[model samples]
Target: MACILRGLIRLSGLDKCINLVELNLAGNQISKIEGLEATLQLRRLILTSNKISAIEGISHLSRLEGLWLQDNRLASLESLALPQLAQLPALRSLYLQNLDRLAPNAVCRTPGYKAAVLAALPNLTNLDGERSPAALNYAELAAEYDAFRANPVPPKQWVVPDVAPWLAGVSQEVPMGGGPGEVALQQRHAKLLPLRFGAAPCVSGQVVKVIDECEMLVRVLGEEIAKFGRQAEARKSSAVAS
Candidate 1:
């Protein structure tokens, strides 16, 4: 038999009919379902856009080549167990569309969603229109829709914990004599050390001043040492007076 059971429901004995190839139960209102394994030879099962939200009973149809599931309230497709369908040796195509809950604008716009779906379903070559869901211009529309849906942005938290520590330490005394070059050096170190330590450390002004005074002292001492060397005899007489 090429076909059988055009609209049979709750008939447990229909399982004995193994020669059936095509079964069409489009509008039987057969919401609750079980036991269709008798039709093992079935190739095409047309249950398109029906109230069958859970495709649990259809898993045993190993010979099924095509399934039409569209225009349904299939919110959680992740729950639908179609592992066997993916492994179907003869199955070439599977159609699932018109899911009401999933926002058409959101799914098409978000790059993250598209990336996740493509990674999950490699065999699913086409969705909505393009070959890859990544090509959709959903990001823009989704941003607008999300802004409309979400609550207004809260005020800026400038006095948060991250800045609070710095605020408390800002009043501490620090060295006062560092020159521009020394201060610049300390600031540069401040930026670089933060990366190495993975956090910024509090720097004192005293250390900065000390750095500048040291630089000035080095310059003055070097000039005195050079001039003293040129007048060793005069330096000896001066030392006697000391």
Candidate 2:
């Protein structure tokens, strides 16, 4: 049975079909290859026109013979998870062409592309719809590829301004008994202050306002209770005298 273009984000709930074979999940949003570890009988698997970025999590499909992955977002051959594919002894045919995100001069576009793939998967008899020929001299190419993988250039770091010192300056301005100008200044700019700098600039004033409001409400309630008690006692005394 084939399931194509189902708009599935994940390959869940398919593990129950242990005997199922030939699953086709083409033209979907499946980004990862997973949830098919139990389908040991799966021979042909097609995942075309999807949002797949990496090629991991398919080592369990040991019986898979044919695999198709075309018109997806594969950026480079390194994302192919070649080491895992080597474990699939039955994998003879592989389709990896017309990848939307792969560059024109990408490693997959070079002459060594086929050689690298063949070197990685020695059992592959067909690749990208072409019949594999006699083994090519892929030693030098594989060595270079391995070296590049071993020592890739580190990614650049992003530097952002420190917000601690700026927050300290703002806190120092709010006195224990600040004047109305200071309070007004804080209130006016409190909302506009950039909170992304790892400090809650408006919290101090908000906390103070909340405490003051609660105290005022308690005082008002207490006064009302006292007034009610006095009126009740006066009415009882008046009734007893009459």
Candidate 3:
């Protein structure tokens, strides 16, 4: 562990260390991972608590097994590729959490971060020096479920019903035939049903399971209706304010 207050600003002057197997450069001011291409026999690399943002270089380390890169400035793992951890076959152990040295990287704070990492690097036997089989398994399952259904929705104009009649209760029946925008409103909601259910897609199997899915569907439908009512109320308020 190097001094946290003062550390190397750059990684250099290791051209001669060709046979270096393990390199520990924790708690440094180094902003980049560079100047280690000649270390062909490199195995273990520790680089915790540095200013490094994007993960680059070190694609030549074919024999690498352990990698420590906690407390860095890495943003998102989605943007990294070409020579990513997946390309490294021998890598088994990885450390990417900060304790007392400095703050953890931004990727660590992302939702399903561990799942993303494990999904990208399936061979990783250890993560952050430990393993929780239950959590990892759930993450993997969640990642798989969202992979295909996760579609980017485009901004489209939607015609929502004036909900006042919808909320007028059973005493007053809503018109059997809506006046003008009813067809467009129905069509719009038809298209949006899939988008709303994408998060909690239906599961098929036993009778009880299908019943549970139906229950969830009813609950989501109720919530969506309530949300539309609220949106209509908000629009009315905004119009009055103007």
Candidate 4:
């Protein structure tokens, strides 16, 4: 699911989607990276151009393939960054920078950042959109990871004590704005705007407003009708399965 530039303030409403394979939430005001524990099968996780300052509660995404976290506020490496990602054995692509876009976490500026990351996650084929050297023996690097995993050490707290929500998969913060409801309300008012003039088109407003209002209403209602229709249609198609 791609939800880019939606003005999302918080990362909410992905708790129960255990089968979610990919999620892209770029260009938003999200401050924290929480929720999404149930999506163990998730592959591509894109969260660039966000305000994410910390990375926690995102452990054990073993099936993740691509992770994009560039252009964020992540700082520090040892404290919470690497440990949260240590379990993603299937992750092959990790992006933290975009050439001319110049998007990178604060930690990327630190010396040996690339080397240290490659050393830790041996399976990565691409880092910051650059391919790892073919000459590098990934098999040799695998042993080091195996050793580290076999005798894991507890990670220290990042100032505050590390605490996950009572429910791991629940959304920590809901995005600001009433979303569709607010849109619908605005549209309803706009739809009846011309009515305010009592049967006269002399209200003198943008035609875009009327179109927006009607479209928003149609979209909102159409989705509801489609949702129920799908459920009803499914039963007709397969009675035994239903």
Top of the candidates by TM-score: 4
Error of 2 at 191 (Å): 99
Alpha carbon deviation, residue 125, candidate 4 (Å): 0.6
> Measured by TM-score, how close is model 1 to the native structure?
0.40
Judge candidate 3 against the unseen true structure and give its global Cα lDDT, from 0 to 1.
Answer: 0.68
Deviation in angstroms for 57 in model 2? 1.4
TM-score, every prediction: 0.40, 0.50, 0.50, 0.51
Better of 3 and 4 by lDDT: 4
Instruction: Tell me the tens digit of each residue's lDDT in model 3 across 110-183.
Output: 78877677778877787775554324554456567677468646669899866554323222221223444444
For 77-127, candidate 4 gives per-residue lDDT tens digits of 763377557677787888777633278788877777777787777778887
* Maximum-lDDT candidate: 2
Sort the predicted structures by lDDT, highest score first.
Answer: 2, 4, 3, 1
Output the TM-score of candidate 3: 0.50
Evaluated at residue 204, the lDDT of candidate 3 is 19
Displacement of the residue 237 alpha carbon in candidate 1, Å:
99
What do the candidate models score in CA lDDT, each in turn? 0.55, 0.72, 0.68, 0.70
Error of 1 at 131 (Å): 8.2
lDDT of 2 by residue, 2-44 (tens): 4444778887787677887788898788888888877888888
**Which ranges of candidate 2 are over 4 A from the true structure?**
1-5, 98-107, 133-242
Residue 147's C-alpha lDDT in candidate 1? 92
